[model samples]
Target chain A: MSILINKDTRVICQGITGKVGMFHTKGCLEYGTQMVGGVTPGKGGTTVEGLPVFDTVAEAVEQTGCDATMIFVPPAFTADAILEAVDAGLKTVIAITEGVPALDMVYVYEVVKRTGVNLVGPNCPGVITPEECKIGIMPGYIHKKGPVGVMSRSGTLTYEAVWQLSNLGLGQSTCVGLGGDPIVGTSFIDLFKMYQADDDTEAILMMGEIGGTAEEEAAAFVKQHVTKPVAAFIAGRTAPPGKRMGHAGAIISGGKGTATEKVAALEDAGIEVANGPADMGAALQRAMKRGR
Target chain B: MKVHEYQAKQILRDAGVAVPEGIVAKTPADAAAAFDKLGGSIAVVKAQIHAGGRGKGTLKEHPDQRGVQLVRSREEAEQVAARLIGNTLVTIQTGPEGKVVNQVLVEAGCNIARELYLGIVLDRSAAKPVVMASSEGGVEIEKVAEETPELIFKEHFTPDRGLDDFQVRKLCSKLNLAGASVSSAMRFMKGLCRVYSELDCSMAEINPLVVTADGELMALDAKISFDDNAIFRHPQLKELRDRTEEDPYELRAGDAGLSYVKLEGNIGCLVNGAGLAMSTMDLIKLHGGEPANFLDVGGGANVQQVTEAFRILLDDKNVKAVLVNIFGGIMRCTTIANALLEAYKSVGFNVPLVVRLEGTEVEQGRKIIADSDVDIITAEGLTDAAKKVVAAATGATA
Candidate 1:
């Protein structure tokens, strides 16, 4: 009942033999993600943790029926890799690669919209459906099957919130890293809608940061459509305007995208917001009390 | 990444945008020559920098025709140029450490009937490059936004899909534009788009695209910022970065491939996790002292990276102290400590350095640093390290 990936989701590792790809693929396999195959030209016929490898995405899709593709390719080749995945008709693409060119993301948007495949990130940690499926680099120990739906722009903070949630024994339904690039595959609104429809997800925990209109757009959607109680935490409370804060997509530009603005937007939409970084779990717990 | 006004105008003229005749000057002598080049009585001496505060300051007018009035004379021009040459001149249009000026624009002042701003920049929300037009363009676009929000007109363009005839017509109609000016602006954007696509630009702007009484859409300023990663494609722009005007720490950090942005704070941050880096800064403040800079030598920093990071961090005079918060993760703490000790020996800093190493190899890393005899204060927890830094910097009990 998660938003993106689940038990039945067949996945492909785009740069399977690469360091990041190999590391996360093993973790995903251990977490019970349905790792069907991998794509790395010239590394075809090799097996990583017993998963089949193909030279091309087209071949991998044809042979193994991999539905989701997690890309860990280098920045320069990421665009081509994404185009290839899109061409092969992958319904879900999660990019663990960072620093993909903004212009390249424009192409990703085009390919996703034209092909109707859900593209997750160019610089995100990735999506995790707790114990059902673990994609990307999130520490598998911190997440488990629960009713709370989570989405974040920061990869590490997602881990932080997940650790906190798991500590409370609340677990999670789906935690999607929408990515922290100036432009990304999906917006918060798109993910929120999916979470809203899932009955298994009783509440949503949106982890946002300063920058872009994604959170505001999500708040608007929550106000109009989402029936589930939502709690949120916007990072960069101490960050100055226009600073990168590590994530490429995260910056307070033109004084528009600040923690204050985001928290207010969420609060105005009737969602609960933590005062700062430490109160994320407490905020969600408070929101749940009110929702009933 | 913003190019100077004069430099940007030259690029615009090359892109076929009609621009006013201008020359960059370094001295009042240079200004006189440029003034003569105009074949007119006056010239505009602009303090060319990546920032936008020059207009409000003494940067917008020509030097006095006679004896050097530091505000208007050749000697004054020399003095102004001297002070501004390598320093970042803060401006309104631009923010912070301005675009460093290696050259100055000594131009023939425009005979303006009206001033308008026409800018094309990345629109974060729409995830598209937008062309922003303001009829009230002479003043800062921000002022126009705060006072008269209705004056700003934004027209977005998808880079692959070029602007069409209708958009051009609408832009002209909204601008109340007329004559050859319309065609020229259209040609400029078309060529500009060519440059934007070909050069891989993040933003291309023309502030105060002056509509002369003579009827021309003359480009008064050209400000272009290429995507930093895309700079490799446009090898020529690599020469445009001026480190002289930058925070010494930022320059050194950049050279070392670490993301370090200086702030007016007392606590120094060295965190393994990017998210942890920020959270550490907030927590540092929560414990009562500001963070001096946002420095994250991303996960798994080796000896050279950590040393370079220390060198950069110490360069910040604003950083009264440092708080090394490492949630070891996959990054080896031993490597960071070795680097820290190496940087300390090389830089010979007397400032207090507090290290909080957690996760894998913490004991081994701490033992290495301890063996180095570098006199670094080691903390067992995040809160303990933050308190140590705050006390060291502000002389207050944390």
Candidate 2:
């Protein structure tokens, strides 16, 4: 009943020969993900971790019938790898590589839309359906299969929220990292729809940051459409204006994208807002009670 | 990845966009020579900094002196440049501490018949590059958007197609441009759009897109910022970065592949992930303590980056305590623990330190810290970490 991915979803790794790619591929495999094969351009016809390697995504798909892909290509070539996966009819493409050019993402966003493909991230930890499957760099032990669905714009922060929830005896249906970049493949609204439709997901937890109106837009959408209880924690409240706090996309610029404004928007939409990082679990508890 | 006005004008001019000719001068003598070379009776000397609102900004030492001033003679240009260069400028954008103006741009004055506002930015909601124009110029665009929203006309264009001719024409008509000015506006706007896309600009703004007496459209002021993620493709744009305009600690952190921003607080925070770093700052503030800086060691941060991050955090004189919060994902908790031990031995932490490690290999990481002889306070959770760090920073018993 988990959204986006589960045990039956066979996946391939792009750029699986690289150090980071290989390390996380093994991590995903150890998490019991259906790691079928890998693609490394020139390094085809090889074997790694007892899995076959192919030259292109198409070949990998043909040989293994993989329906999903985890991309670990470098930033410069991440867009091409994503397009290759989409062109090969991979239903779900997850890009874990960071620093992909904004223009490249802009073009990729349009193509992904035209082709009806679900793209997860270019600077994110990827996705996980608790014990069923894991397709990202997030720590696998912190998650437990349950009713809550989590989505966030950060990696470690997502882990923080999940840890709090799991410690509070609330396991997750799925956790999706939407990435920290200014331009990404997925948005909060897109994931909200899936979480609302998933039978296993009784509640939703959203983690957002300063910069951009995505949270505000998501708040508006949730108010109009979502029936599931939702709680959110927006970071960067203590951030000064015009200063980029770590993330490239996280900044208050031209009097816009302030945390104050985002918090006000989320609260106005009837979503429970966490007071701080430690309050995420409590806020979700309050949201679920209110939904009942 | 923001370029100075002079640098932005140079980039725009090279991209076939019409901009006022300007020369960057680091000294009064260079400014005087530039004024003389321009051969104009009236020239503008502008303080070159990364912030905007420079035209209305005032010098801290000489409140009567403006950052941007019109000079009648070469000596006047030199005098204005002398007052601006090496002086702190306090603008609406720059904080009260002000930014040190290291250079001045001396440019020939423009004959402005009319002024308009033009800006190109990636519209996050629309998921496309948008060109915004307004007849109200030489003022803050935010003010216009807030006060008279309809005055701003926006046109969204895809990256591959760029700004279409019809979009430009529609904007010109909306701006009340007619006759030869319409065609000039078309060329100016289209060329600017081309430069915006080709250069991977995050924002390209002309506060006052001036229409001359001869019906020629020119960019009187240019403020361009390229996408930092896209800067790798444009090697030439990388050279345009002004290190003097940035904080030394932040620059050092960037060199070490850490994302850091210096803030005016006492508690230094070193954490993983941007969101977690910011949330750590918020928690510190919530616990009645202020964070000195925001430093994200980043996912998969190795021993070197962690050690460097510690050095940068400890280097801040305002820091009274340091907090390390790591929720390991791709980055393991043991790696952070080992790095912390390495940093404790190499950099030597003088400030009271608090560490919170969670996620993968937590026990091993905690064991590493416990086994080490370094003095450290360990917390179990995020709330405990924040309260302990705040108490430690305030010199109170926790």
Maximum-lDDT candidate = 2
- Candidate 2 regions exceeding 4 Å error are B396-398
TM-score of 1: 0.89
Model 2 agreement with the true structure over B1-398: per-residue lDDT tens digits: 88899999998898888988888999999999999999989999999999988888899989999989999999999999999989999999888989999999999998989999999988877778899999999999988988999999999987778888898889988988989988888789888989998899999999899999899999999999999888888998889998989878888988999988888899999999899999999999988999999989888888899889988988878888999999988878898899899988899888889999998999999999998999999999998999999989889323
State the lDDT at A270 in candidate 2.
Answer: 90
The pairs that clash in candidate 2 are none
| Best by the DockQ measure | 2
Q: TM-scores of the models, in the given order?
A: 0.89, 0.98
Q: Write the per-residue lDDT of candidate 1 for residues B68-142, one digit (tens) a residue.
A: 122434444455555555444444544633445566676666678778887776676777777788898767676
Top candidate (TM-score) = 2
Positional deviation of A92 in candidate 1, in angstroms?
0.7
Please report how far candidate 1 places residue B276 from its true position, in Å: 3.6
